[model samples]
Target: MDPVDYVFTVRTGDRKNAGTDANVKVILHGDGGRKTDKMKLRNILKNDFERSQIDNFTVKKQFKIRNIEKLELWRDNFGLGSAWYLDYVKVRRKDKDTEYSFPVFRWIPAKTHLIFRVNDTSLPQQDPEAEQRWNELKRKRDSYIVCQKITGGPAQVIKLYCSTSLKGQVPKRK
Candidate 1:
């Protein structure tokens, strides 16, 4: 396989304490079972992954991964303020004009791993990875339960509740 270059742009959320000092890594997954080894994201000269910052990283691999499907990202719980708030990631192959965007507007706790799939609006049944789709749906179904608080009332899905203190810590929308 010919070596290919890929550029990854990571955006940090513009919220209080949204940056992290821990080491971050990523793995790119593509079609036909193609994947890349975990690569570290770092900038030695300047502090990276700061709040509201967009950092770019270049990765060169011998294998040319076609049609990127997902990105696996994680951070090592090292140093102070390890939690991070990721806004999104954009990836583009050097020779390709098309760019892939993965939106992940959420907080990543210390030492946590998360998978961000491409923004394909396909239904679960239409997903190519049947096992993954099934597992994801099953997990969601198990985590949320339907309950009726009042008689003859509509049922609501009950999932994990956020603590008031935690909610207060979140920044209010402008």
Candidate 2:
């Protein structure tokens, strides 16, 4: 299962004492269309409830999910008396052209998963050397194919195969 990581930034209202005290939960839908529950991602406003000055508060959080095909985010207000604002979610995949941004004028749905399409231009690009290597591998399309989440870091190590027919075989990393 491939693991995907995401970072979300959010803020609440300007009211000093009115914000969420509940935890935000993220649901991951993986291959075969299965949903897996992840740990609650705590909100900054909730953590610092006492020191909050309430001037357009904002907070950032990072979470990871393995075998993620799609994901849904939810937060239960439980009559917390205030609505939370989701600014945006940043995904590591380069195949997405834009980050997920929430609308400022409307209230977001209580239950929904944000969906995004992977575009060609959004795929991540490594350094010059890595780019050159990738191009070389791509040229031999019949012989090699690169898979996602090969490895994490500035220089990503994509899983590849010597040939398309060679399943269950991991080509040596150059």
Candidate 3:
């Protein structure tokens, strides 16, 4: 197979201490269980993974990856202040004009591995990954609890848990 070029655009969250100096790696998973070896993301010309920054990186793959399904991203946690807040990651195949976006709006602590599925909405019952779907639903239910704000009124929702790094940083409602 001819070598293919994949462009990865990583967007860092625009929050205090959201950047990290640790080395980051990614693995692309495609249909039929095809996957690429872990590839390091780096750009020597300028500092990467800074807060509110978009960094582009290219990786050459010897095999073709069709229909990217999931992305595995992690950091080596090798540098000071290694915790990172990632907004999202977009991947594009230059030759095929194919693109996939993974929405990962969360903080990734040191030595954490995050697997993001392609940005596709599906019912939990129809989701292919049973474990992932269950866990996600459970987490959301635990974090966003339902309560009755008034008697004989519609139930109100509230988020009971917030990350320590995001406390007092969330934008106020307009």
lDDT of each structure? 0.78, 0.41, 0.80
Quote the lDDT for 73 in model 3: 86
Better of 2 and 3 by lDDT: 3
Instruction: Give the alpha carbon lDDT tens digit for every residue of 47-112 in model 1.
Output: 889999999988877357889999888898887888898999998999898899988787775555
Candidate 3 lDDT by residue in tens digits, 10-129? 999999999999999988899999888888899987889999999999987645687899998889777787879999999988897778999888777556566788995567687666
Q: After superposition, how far is residue 152 of candidate 2 from its true place, in Å?
A: 67
Worst 10 residues of 1 by lDDT: 165-174
- Let me know the TM-score candidate 2 reaches against the reference structure: 0.34
Sort the predicted structures by lDDT, highest score first. Answer: 3, 1, 2
Residue 90, candidate 1: C-alpha displacement in angstroms:
0.5
Candidate 1 residue 65 Cα shift, in angstroms, is: 0.4
- Model 1, total clashes: 0
Name model 3 segments beyond 4 Å from true.
120-174
- Provide backbone clash counts, one per model: 0, 4, 0
Task: Work out the TM-score per prediction.
Answer: 0.69, 0.34, 0.70
Q: Which stretches of candidate 1 lie over 4 Å from their true place?
A: 120-174
Candidate 2 per-residue lDDT, tens place, 29-148, comes to 546666544535554444522222222222223233334444455666544543454433333322233344432212233343333222212333633235533554464454443443
